[model samples]
Target: MDQDDSETCQMCPMDEWPNREKTRCLPKLQEFLSYKEDKMASFFCFLVILCCVITCFTLKKFILYWDTPLVKANNRTLSFTVLVSLLLSFLCVFFFLGRPLDITCMLRQTLFGIFFSLAISSLIAKSMMVCIAFKATKPSSSWKKWTGVTLPYSIVVVCSSVQVLICVSWLSTYPPYQGFDMTTYPGKIIIQCNEGSDIWFYSMLGYLGFLAAVSFVLAFMVRTLPDSYNEAKYITFSMLVFCSVWIAMIPAYLSTRGKYMVAVEIFAILTSCAGILSCIFLPKLYILLIKPYLNTRKHVFSWVRK
Candidate 1:
């Protein structure tokens, strides 16, 4: 045999076998690529959710801070932090839009990140609020009127800023055209942030999961309180909706494949809609505008919107 043939036989490891490598690595790469594509797609739905989450929590906090008995008399540290963090969260979405990457992708990640921050902030604030509310009526009496929003958004903001910065630096370090793309399928190349492993994505899932869990536990506690406490019920119900929405995301995340994961994001928009409609606004409207119906009850056919 020739010297070249000998070298080829000796150097070829099992993984480097020509056709065999194609069989194993190619399929695995395709699955991963599909996953990446789905991640990108899901980003769209995530943006709408981010808007909803931020708008609901931040605006209501502003209103609540102005006059709610929940934060009766404590330091405004949490309140101010949540407020400022929310503002920054919204700004993050806006500035993220101007990134050179595909606007659609930027929109998705920005929205997702903001939504995440708000979710965390809401959980922290709600848990504290619930605890304070319960404790206020008890022995210590120190928590009277001390309702503070849990400014978890601050940590989320810093973490998200770093994540975005990492992604931006990775993308800008080289022009898109010159980037190394893994060709996973025929005529298809995987475009990923590649800051590291998919840890960022999983971190999101983990954080969101933690927030949802806190919301669920506190909501359970709130519901068990006296029915005379109607305000508690409303907040609890809203939290229930938020928690459920985040919980439902687990399956979508698992089943998603690249570019298709956007469907999961779209789902977020619908959930956010439900959260706003059923949780916060509907209850308040019922209390404010429709409560009069309780005294002079009347019925009418609903009018259809054109």
Candidate 2:
């Protein structure tokens, strides 16, 4: 065809582009979650960073009071592990904030699922540890031998390994990639990550929820155990918050499209993780930093009697 008979394409305005006919323009694909283009992404990035800083402060406190009876009573190793996982989970939000590149799309859900699994698994292990501690206090109880860090560490490892395997299978079977949905909205393109398989995504979430539910039930049953330093009560509340946020998130996430959907998942991640961090650890931090006397063995025993 002659040059005049052929078509030419030129760059359109921001968030718009020429249609196939090239005579008119339509809304462009909203591809990126950049700070300049979307303030919501920027806001979430700030939140993630803030939460990370808080996690650091919490870790510092835990290390400083590592020798205290209150800190010792709660398995310190498990505590540190849980804190680190929570921090990683918060940092994972950064993946959701940026553009949905090939690598980010592939790793975001996998890492998020793994980190959350680790956190929930740690909570479950801690709850089991609390139960073991109380049972072992009984004279001649066989649970005494299992009341060490070994069980909790094993629980974290086994639970996390399962998630790792699931993610590996998901990536191996149908890995996610940068996708564009051109028909979702009229005359507009929605750029997002195609999460490959719904089964794998929901399966990961289901498994994490199962761990949380078990943790909640165990912690609730043991919350009344006679120890002022007990963590069962805190675990119960944290699991409640964690389960509630994700449960509500599923429908909201499915109802939205494009960037809003991403926003919903990010919101769920931040809120659920923050719930675990604040509920499980803040009370201990209060005692460790603000009221050191309450962290002593004498105070624990005294409160147990009252």
Best by lDDT: 2
Off by over 4 Å in 2: 1-22, 25-31, 302-306
Candidate 2, 1-306: lDDT as tens digits: 112345754556545666666666676656557777898988998899999999999999999989888888778888998999999999999888767888999999999999989988888898898888778877999999998767888999998899999999999998889987766775566778998998998888888888889989989988997667688898899989988898899899989998899999999999999999999899998888798888888866554455
lDDT of 1 by residue, 86-195 (tens): 34443343322212245444344545555445544544554456556666766669887463333434544554455455445534453222122444344334443322
Shift of residue 44 alpha carbon in model 2, Å: 0.3
Candidate 1 regions off by >4 Å?
1-107, 138-196, 228-248, 269-273, 292-306
Pull out the clashing pairs in model 2: none
Whole-model Cα lDDT of every candidate shown, in order: 0.45, 0.86
Worst 10 residues of 1 by lDDT: 297-306
Candidate 2 TM-score to native: 0.90
